[model samples]
Target: MDKKNIKKVVLAYSGGLDTSIIIPWLKENYNNCEVIAVAADVGQGSGELEGLEEKAKKTGASKLYIADLKKQFVEDYIWETLKADAVYENKYLLGTSFARPLIAKRLVEIAQAEGADAICHGCTGKGNDQVRFELSIKAFAPNMPIIAPWREWNIQSRDEEIDYAEAHNIPLKITRETNYSKDKNLWHLSHEGLDLEDPANEPQYNKPGFLELGVSPEQAPDKPTYVTIHFEKGVPVSLDGQKLCAVDLLSQLNKLGGENGVGLADIVENRLVGMKSRGVYETPGGTILYHAHNKLEEICLDKDTYHYKQGIGEKFAELVYDGKWFTPLREALSAFVDSTQGTVTGDVKLKLYKGNIIDAGVTSPYSLYDEEIATFSADDVYDQSDADGFINLFGLPLKVQALKKLKLGK
Candidate 1:
C-alpha cells in the first residue's frame, strides 16, 4: 500500500482490459515507478498474443516478456492432473484452475530475473484465480510483494473498467455490449456474464462467440464419429494410430470432439472465495482424454488399488483446485498416481454423437482380466470346490453373532 517505498514492479499482464489499465495505474500510484509486463502464452490463441508486445508498451509498460508456455502447460500441468483423475466436484476438469500457477510461476521468474521490488496481478478479489496466482507466487517466492489492483483500487465493475480503458486510451479485444469474460487455452474455453448471470436462464449457445470450441448437441451431425486414442504410462501418446506432439494431439481431438458435441458443461461451482459462480466451459479434448484414460485404468488396475485410487483422485482435485500445486502433498500424491499407472498402457475407442461418449472398444496388453478364470462355463482355472472353505471363514463372524443371539433370545 506504501507507494513511496516501492520502486520497480513486475506485472502478470494478459493484454486484457484489467491488465492494460493496471500498468498505468501502478505508475500513477507508485511514484511513477517502472512496470515490466510478463505475459505467459499458455496457448490461449494466436490472436490474443498477436500485438501483445506492442500493446503492453503502448499501455505504459517499460517492456513485455512473453513466455511461451504452451507445451509445458499441456505436458506438465494438464497431464499430471489427468493421471490423478482429478475432476473438481465430479464435473470441472479444472481448466483455469491449473493454468494460473503456470502463469504465476513465470511471473515470479521474471520478477526475480529483473530484481523488481514487487509483483502485480490483474486478478479481482472475488474470483478463484486471485488465490491461484497469489498462492503460487508465495510458494515460489515467499518474500515477494504482490500488488493486486482489484483489491486496492477504486474500480468496482467491468463497465467502469471499460470506461477507464476508454479514458486512458487503452485498446481492448472487447467492447461494452459484446464483452463477456472469457479464458481460453489449449485445454478449454470458459465463458461467463451476460445472460449467464441468472441460473434460471438457458444458455444461448447458438449466439455468436457463445460456443467457441464447438456446436451444441442439438446442432451436431446425425451420424456418429469414432476416435481411437493410445496411451503409454497413463499419458496419451497418439490419436487414431497417428503419433503427434502433445499440443497437436489435443488440437486434433478438439477439432474432432467439437464437431460431435463432445464436451460442454454449465456448472455453478463453489469458488474458493466462498461464493458460487456459474460458467459455461467447453473442454472438447479434455473430455475425450479423461474417458480414454479412465477406461484404460479399468483393465490395468487391480480392484483394491483401483477402488482406493478413486478417493485419492478427489483429494488430488481439491489440492489442485485450491492452488496447492507446489505443495509436497501434491508431489507425494502424484508419486502414488504414477506408481499405479505403470501398467496403464492401452487404446480406448469411443463413439461421439450428440454429446454421448459411448464406448466402442478398449484394449490393453497388461490387462488383468482372464476369460478362463472369470467365465461361468466349465474351466480348470477356477475350481468350484475351492470356494467352500473360503466362504466359511468369510462368514464366520456373522454366523457366530446369529447363534449367540439365538441362545440369548428374550
Candidate 2:
C-alpha cells in the first residue's frame, strides 16, 4: 500500500483514455518504479493490438505484455456465461463485465510473475471495473497492493487526463475530438458518452461514436438471411453446418447478425457502483448465439429444468455483474449449469431480418419435446382420463379451501 516502497507495478492497459497515461502516472507517483503494462488480447480486433507494444514502451512502461487470450476467453468466460443464459437486465450480453475478470486474472498472474509490489488498473471511480479488477486481484493475491489512479490522482476529468498525456508526450491513439468511450472485443462493441449521455436522445447509430461493429437496423439488408447454428453440449460448434472454432464461429455470426441489423441494444442499466448509465451495445454474434441457444434449450431441456434455469440465469447474471466470477458460489452455479446443458445439443435455424431473429426450425437427438404426445390430434401415448386424477391431486389444497369456505356459510 506504500507507494514509496513500491519497486514495480503491473497495470491493466488497453491503450484507452484511462490506461494510455497510467504507465507514466504509475512511474511518477510510485517512486519512479518500473511500470509493466499487460494488455489482454480478448479479440478487440487487430487495429487496437497492432502498435500497442511500442505504444506502451513509448509511454514509459518497462515492457508490454500482450496476452493473446482470445480462444481462452471465448472458451472459458464467454461460453460458460452463455451456457448459463446470463444477460444483465434482460439485454446486456455482459461483454465488458465478463472480460474484466479474465483481464484482471492475467494482470495478477503477470504481477506475481514479475515480482511486482502492486497491481494497477485504469478503471474510473464511477465505473464497475474498479471493483471487478480489484476484487479479482485480491482473490488471487490478497496482500498485494492495488494502485487505482482514477481514485487517487489529481487528474479528474477526461480533459485533465488529456492535458497530462500531452504534457508527458504520451502518444494517445485517441483524440479529444473522439469523445465517446468505447470498449470493443470479439463478443461485442460498447459505446458510451457523446449524445448518449442524455437518455431522452435517440442514439444516432450512423453518427460518429455510436456505430462500430455493425450497421443500424435501417441500414441492414432488405431480404432475410438464414443462419443455421450447430451446438454440442450447449456450446455453438458451427455456422451454416460448417464447423468453426469458437472465435471464428462467433465472428461469422457477427457478420451475419450485423448484416441483418441484429444485436443493437440501447439500455440504461443499474451499475454495480449504484449509479445508472446509458449505453449502446453491438453484440451481433452473441445475439444470434443467445437466441439460437435458447431455441435449442426449448426442445432439448425438460420443462422443469428449462423453467428453473431462468432463475439460475438471473443469479448468474448478477454474479457476473457484481464481479463475483472467482467466488465459490459462481463455480457451484456453473457446475449446476453444466449439468443442465448435457442434453442441450441441437441445431437451430434462424431467420435474421431487420433486427429480428425469427425461428425457422430446431432439431436435436436429445430433444425432450415429443411431437406425438404434444400433438392436438389424438395419440395412444395420452389418455384423457389421466387429467381427472392429476387435476384433483394438483388442486386438492384449493378444493379443501373451497369446501371450508362453503361450510362457513359466508
Candidate 3:
C-alpha cells in the first residue's frame, strides 16, 4: 500500500486523546487526504459525543459520521456474551474487549460505503485493541489496507503525543495530571495508566474525580438493596415486575447497582499481547446481571449440563478476550450455550450489600430440583433399600481389590 495512492481514509474516531490528534496526523502524512471520521455510539453517553462533529472538523476531518450502535451493541454483542457467561481472567467483564470488533465492523462498512482507500484506528501497537480491530477488519475486508498511527508514527509516549497535539494546536480537555487511559461503554468503565500502572498502588475509588460510576464499598449504604431480575430463555427481559428494553433494563440496573457499590474490580490481568496489565473496572449493571443469570441457571440446568457449561463459559471468555468473536468456534459455542438456555427462564432475587451479591431466591418452571425425592424423611419415590444395591455396584471395583489384597496377605 503506497501512501501516494491513498486518496481517502476512514478513521474509527472516539474524540479521545489518541484519536483527537490522529485526525491531523492522517491529513499531514497522507498528502492532505480526505479523512472521514466515524464515531460509533455504543452508549458511551452524550457527554463523550457532545460537540464531537465540530471537534472533528476543527481537527482537519473532511466529514464526520456518528453511527448509533447502542441497541445493536447490547442486543447482539453484549447479550450474546452474557448468555455465554463469559468472564475474562475470572475478573474482567470484557467491556472494552468485545466493543472493538463491533466498532471495527462498522468502520469497515463505512469505509466500503464511502469508497475509501484505507481505514485507520488509534489503537496502540502494544495493546490488545490493535489486534482486535485489525482482526475484525481482516474478517470483513481481507484486502483493505489499515493505518495504525501509534505504530507508524515516531511518537514514543503519551507525553510525545501531547507535545505533538500542542504543536498542532489541537485543544484537549485533559492534561498530564488527569490523563488516565479510560474506556467506557454502557456495560462498564475501565481505568488504567498513571498510578494505576503499578500493581502496588491501591485504586483511589473514594477520592474525588477518581470513580465515575459508583462509590467504594466503605461508602455504600448500611441496608442491603434487593433486586429481582426476570429472565426469558437466558436473556434478562424485566427488572422487578416491569418489562423493559435491553438498553433501558441495563440503564436502570446501572443506576441501582451504582448506588449500592455492587461492582468494582481491581485486577492485574494477563493481556493477549503477552504482558500483565493492571486495570480497575466499574461494571455495576453488568455485575448484577451476571449474578442474577448464574442464579437462574443453577436451578434450571441439570447437574451435568451446568457443570459442562462452566468449561464452555471459560473458553467463551478466552475467545471473546482474544478478539475472536467472528470466528466459527465462538459461534458453535454460542449455539451450545443457547441450547442450554432453553430452561434458563426464571426470576432471580438478589441482595446487594456493599460489593457483595447474595442470592435471596431463585425460581424456574423448568427446575429439576425435586424436593420430594431429595427429602431426608421417608419417601416412596426413593426406596431406602435401593441404596444398598446401588452402593455395592458402584463400589464393586474397590471391594474386589480389597478382597484380593486380604486373601494374598500371607
lDDT of 3 by residue, 156-234 (tens): 9888888988999988878999889999999999999999999999999899888888888888899999989999999
All candidates: CA RMSD (Å) = 1.5, 1.3, 1.6
Ranking by lDDT: 3, 1, 2
In candidate 2, what residue range of length 10 has the lowest lDDT sum? 205-214
Clashing pairs in 1: none
- Flag the better candidate by lDDT, 2 or 3: 3
lDDT of 2 by residue, 1-410 (tens): 66788999888989987899888888777888999989899999988988988988988888999999999999999999999999899999999999989998899899988999888888899999889888888899899899898889887788788898889888777777776788999999988886789999998977743577778888888999998999999999998889999999988888889878899999999999899999999999999999999999999888889999999999999999999999999999999999999989989999999899999999999988888999999899989899999999999999999999999996
Candidate 1: Cα lDDT at 251: 91
- How much lDDT does each candidate structure score? 0.91, 0.90, 0.92
lDDT of 1 at 60: 88
Q: Give the candidate number with the greatest lDDT.
A: 3
Candidate ordering by TM-score (highest first): 2, 3, 1
List runs of model 3 lying over 4 Å from the truth. Answer: 400-410
lDDT of 1: 0.91
Q: Candidate 1, residues 75-149: lDDT per residue as tens digits?
A: 999999999999999999999999999999998998999989999999899998889999999999999989999
